[model samples]
Target: MTNPTPGQTVSGTITVAANATDNVAVSSVQFLLDGQPLGNPVTAAPYAASLNTTTSTNGAHTLSAKATDPSGNVGSAAGIAVTVQNPTPPMTCFVLQTSVTARGTGTVQTGAFSTVISGEVLLAFVSMDGPGGAAGQSATVSGAGLTWRLVGRANSRSGDAEIWTATASTVLHNVTARSAPAKGGYAQDLTVVAFEGATGTGAVSTGGAASGAPTLTVTTTAATSLVLAVGHDWDKAVARTLPTGFAMLDQCVDTAHGDTSWSEYTNQATGPAGTPVKIGATAPTSDQWNMAAVELLNSGS
Candidate 1:
């Protein structure tokens, strides 16, 4: 058997594969889950089935295969024990932008703002007004007793933008932003745009890394309903590779100057509980302007 190994945990749809041998030429092979037949018997090699585990109970189950030969002989393999898990609940995300403010000529700026809804996970994007040419200039958004993770970066006609996320409520306080070597020339205006979501009975977790490269990897705690985002400072053409069990949600590219670019990607697929989400970029340089973030929600079961 190639899937649903003994003690393996499964959810959603899973592929099962098996091989059988018999004397006097094998006539057919039949697969079963918990003693129930799965489709019809197979008379050829590479026997397989796509089984949806959502219909079964959220616990242990058994899988077996029986083979019959043309000589009227039959043989069966011992049942493989597997665990079934429930699917994660769907999530809805929204975005809201705040009024703009000036960051002055200093390298660092801090301010406070309130969220549109109470008790929602906030993914804040800070846009800076610019004639911005300062390399490695970055921003941070934080509030509600937690510092948000920087998952994205972009450049707008106004300036540069940094994206951050955290689990908090409506009233955010002491949100801060800082840039290295001070923003030169004209002072830039800063605006906050937030992406929020209500996880009803589910929880959200966020994290990221900024080592100045195209790819970033983050770890998450939720086994299901997992979502992820990766933000890079430069707008180079890049692709995202997700860890197992996660699927792509969206990929975005924004550039203010043709040479400088910012990009972000969203994914819904993640591995089982306690698994680290590894994200990769196609053409990552040793630039220290890249970051990644992840958000996870439970199945609400």
Candidate 2:
């Protein structure tokens, strides 16, 4: 055998067993799965084939090996079955930033600060890599005032891509690490929302009161917020980082779209370390209350 299994995703080679009579030379080794060929027969010295397994499906696979000898003669070969298992996704690394500076978990600081979680999406084109995207991606927030949101797609914008949005107003945006490794782990950018007032849903625009005054109405309270001025700790991950060498960047929100409010940002609290930032809706619309998007980046070979 020339090659062993790479964690259950490969099969060993067939070394045409040596025979003293006539230097028994093997014409070729055949591989079959339930009487089906997995790949072309290996004619070279090192006879082995890699198993094509992915995250979507992976498990024990029965494989049969048959060798053909010289002289119009076929010898009885031993049947060997090999198992193929699913390969794990890669873990790609990326830069982790926060909407608000002041590191640490909590007590580091407070206020309506935007934790701008920014990172570059690495593009990788490898056949062995797993799928990469925001299908199972998400984010969260914590503290006395904070909101989370997802926006944009990975590898779609420059380094300054605003993929995540943080709504702060007493509630704090907590940072979440990847739970699993994606295709080498994808690069991502997330912003934590913090410190804000009552959250409103639906639409609100200026000069809509017929008297040049701003007035809006919401049909569902699920898309509104009441707090404001919260700090953020973006770079929060949900499922896992992009595949190794492949990262995704974008944004998301925690409490839906808590932007459309009467006071919008009337009293946006101060940021930690004396920095100033605020989150509010500008001329409310149906989207200002709830919005989200995810961008994934593919890495190169």
Candidate 3:
């Protein structure tokens, strides 16, 4: 006999196989569950039966096989003890806004904060305000003991700013922002936004040409999970797309130059996990672009 070994746990439909022999000639073989007949006896070699494990109680059960010879002599194999287990429940993950900050800076600036929730991953977004539109300027944001790459940037009349982000598993993070050399101007303003309880990983890519669309791609290790794409550029419209098995959670636009407008677009969808997410956008005014992608591993911890 093979399968459903003693003390093994099983669920759903299971297969049981066995072989029997007799001196006179084996006529039939019968299978039993918990000492009761499983079904009609099998009358051939290589005996096998499909047992619906869901129909059995969620506990220990005994399985045995009986064989009968041409002379009507009967023999039974020792019972195998197995356990039936219930189905596992689905996992859930929560997204929460942790903190926000606004600071003035031309050089490197850092913002230190602690997470309010326990066992929560961290994501921080840093937007830098530049004078002559953030077109020729660049900003870098770092936190959670790791440095974040630029995801997207825009330089419109409404504002001249760039957005950067990073993720970490630590509860406390020190976010820093730095801008490239610029003409003598007013102190640039840096805005910081933090997200909690999200599993995030990201990468950065550069544009090949000076006036064409740049494509950024980031892949995750989780087989299935939530994903986010971030794109940045100067004086260009940005858009993002998830992989086949992933859906968008929420998207927000922030302008840090002049008006500092913030808008959110929320729509949920599902896509494949453990795949790469790609974001493509046009950058007409500047040659540089930064992109980041994050995936949430909601595997019940």
TM-score: which candidate is best? Answer: 3
Model 1: lowest-lDDT 10 consecutive positions: 200-209
- TM-scores, one per candidate: 0.36, 0.22, 0.40
Each model's total of backbone clashes: 11, 98, 14
Better of 2 and 3 by TM-score: 3
* lDDT of all predictions: 0.49, 0.27, 0.50
Candidate 2 off by > 4 Å = 1-24, 55-57, 89-301
Per-residue CA lDDT of model 3 for 1-301, tens digit only, reads 5445577666666666566877778899899998899988989755767788888889889999999998889999999998887562243434444445444545545455444333454443333334433254445555456566555554432133444556544434334434442433433444444444345533332222334444445464554444444333433333333334433333333344322212111123224554665544432324343333444454332
- lDDT tens digits by residue: candidate 1, 1-301: 5444577667777656566776468888888999999878878765667678888889999988888998878888788998887773343322222322333444434465443333445544343334434433545554346656655554322245455656654434335443322345433333333333334212232222333334445555555444444343333334444444444433333333222222233344455666665554444454323333445454332
Candidate 1 lands at a TM-score of 0.36
List residue ranges in candidate 3 displaced over 4 A. Answer: 1-88, 99-114, 127-196, 199-209, 212-215, 236-270, 280-290, 296-301
lDDT string, candidate 2, 238-275, tens digits: 12212122222222222221211111222211222222
